[model samples]
Target: MSAKPLTAREAYQVLRDIALGVRTMRRLGEKPLTGVYSGMMSV
Candidate 1:
């Protein structure tokens, strides 16, 4: 069976959610958490 299509608003909301998730992942990945751990181990 074919799925129903989303309305314009639904499509916009889905795009917005996807953009937000990508931004969050980018921000988290930008942080150098591994370096912090290495520094802690050396001290």
Candidate 2:
């Protein structure tokens, strides 16, 4: 969201939001968000 890097808490919040959104989408029968999880793990 910015040119600068996120702080640890900010990063955590962002990731948590993504996970929640992914879960919600899952309930709606969307595809799994392995790309996002894998990207984070790779980093």
Candidate 3:
């Protein structure tokens, strides 16, 4: 992967994909939990 930050449009697309994936997972009865962190992080 390139070590470049995503552009505004790219970031928006990523966020959309993430939201769609979460919705799909929920529909499939999958408990997808995302963990929020400041320094250390996880999903």
lDDT of 1 by residue, 1-43 (tens): 5558788997677668768774232222334665534432210
TM-score of candidate 2 to 2 decimals: 0.45
Give per-residue CA lDDT, model 3, range 1-43, as digits (tens).
Answer: 3357778997677668778884232222254435432232112
Which scores better on lDDT, 2 or 3? 2
Model 1 CA lDDT for position 32: 62
C-alpha TM-score for every candidate: 0.46, 0.45, 0.46
Sort by TM-score, best first.
3, 1, 2
User: Candidate 3: where is the Cα deviation over 4 Å?
Assistant: 22-35, 40-43
Residue 9, model 3: Cα distance from true site in angstroms: 0.2
Report lDDT per candidate.
Answer: 0.51, 0.53, 0.50
Clashing pairs in 3: none
Candidate 2 C-alpha lDDT tens digits along 1-43: 3357789997787678778774232323245556655332311
Evaluation by lDDT, superior candidate among 1 and 3: 1
Note the residue pairs that clash in candidate 1: none
Listed per model in order, the count of residue pairs whose N, CA or C atoms clash below 3 Å is 0, 0, 0
